[model samples]
Target: MWKCLERVLCLNCAFAFAIILARTGASPVIVNGALGYSVSLSPLTSVSQGIDEVVWRRLSPRMKLARCSQGSVQYFNTNYTNRITLHYRNFSLEIHDLRKEDAAEYEVITATGNTGNEHSELFQLKVYGLVSGAHITVQGIFGICNLTLICTVTSGDPTFTWWRNGEALVNDSTQHIRVLGNMLEVHHAAEVKYAVYKCEASNPISKATAEIKLRDVCKLDTSDPLPNSSICAEFQATRSSAATGSF
Candidate 1:
């Protein structure tokens, strides 16, 4: 394992024995749900008051992941209050129904509940997007029509699901979408059907979604807004972790 070190000086200390602080290079520390991403510093300690706030802000000037303060968690500012899942136990933040706006570098701040003295670290998060198209590609012998829907999303290990008229397409044979190289193929598509097809792509730490509407021969692709329920779940799950800056 590769390692790096940082030192702190307490010149006026009363204790005879010196305290040593060694820091390794951003090493791999595991967090829940996020597969490969790791915390640079794991198992951080706080003074007697315990932890108070955990704020994950974009490294730059972009929107930040939800933050947990005191006893409550908030999302995307005020309008999204109580819409985030927080895991304060481990200081981890999870944002569900992620959006493109959520993409960017992030700073995680941890503070002592009583004194409010804080420490923070930064991380980078990238959001992925998808492309989709659909049309009446074939016509049956009688009046039947075969519609094909094609969807392509970025990033590896992306999961694809199909929806029609806001209903999840559960039948594998008729309304199934095939996943291939970040692309989804739907065979025997319905003609003159009006519905929405959504592709949600995510890694353990971050998530993004893309949607397309099927209407006649016209195809419209758009980004789905972050859902309130998903945001709430993300906040609650990560609140504890965020509060303490733990695994």
Candidate 2:
């Protein structure tokens, strides 16, 4: 009898869960959030009326974030104790000061009555960090005047772009310009037409650029058969500092 009773209870729970899933018919909305920023998760379905109680939860490794009922709010997660706000009217949630770990699937459940029926909405939050502290380094081969410019960043995953004289730099075999990932190589440096080179590092949230003068870094006298290593060394020491600015 006990086993039969257990099976009946399991079936009841599954039926209740199916109803909740049916109410949350739409797929989770994608929401991009930046670190140390705020993001709002609003339900597509209107909850202005017939909402007795509202609960917000993180889906995976399930944990309650906040709850609202009878015009009063309660927070459950200690980490987000003072950082989350719940809207009583529409049953929406606003999270502040987002962290990397906050990137996850969230669900808002609304209860209308004692009929055991609940309406739920899901949202997928992706948190990204702002790009910053970008710099460039220059290196040259001993015999040839070929030079490679490398852009490095102190934080954030970013895409790198190379520019010349405020224009986008394109790869051309004839011009000896090659862009490889974060490194830009200039073969036969003297033959290159542009003087000022810029490397821009960017992400979804922000971007930064670092500029370099060709004459400043490549101070070698190309006319001479053998370039002076001492002069190159001196230039390397003085121009080692990268020129950086935010955009």
Question: What total of clashing residue pairs does each candidate reach?
Answer: 33, 0
| Shift in Å, residue 137, candidate 1 | 18
Candidate 2 Cα outliers beyond 4 Å, as residue runs: 1-25, 47-49, 114-117, 141-143, 165-175, 215-219, 222-247
Candidate 1 overall lDDT versus native: 0.43
Candidate 1 lDDT over residue span 1-247, tens digit each: 1222222233324222321111212432333222222222223543234777777655456566566776676667542244345565666665544455554555567777665456655555544432222211111121122334444433344454555556655445344444443344544344545445554444444445556553432222224342322221111001111111212
Which whole-number lDDT from 0 to 100 does residue 26 have in model 1?
43
Q: What value does the lDDT take at residue 161 in candidate 2?
A: 86
What RMSD does model 2 have?
8.2
Clashing pairs for model 2 are none
Give the best candidate by lDDT: 2
Q: State how far residue 95 of model 2 sits from its true place (Å).
A: 2.0
Error of 2 at 116 (Å): 6.5
State residue 186's C-alpha deviation in candidate 2, in Å: 2.3
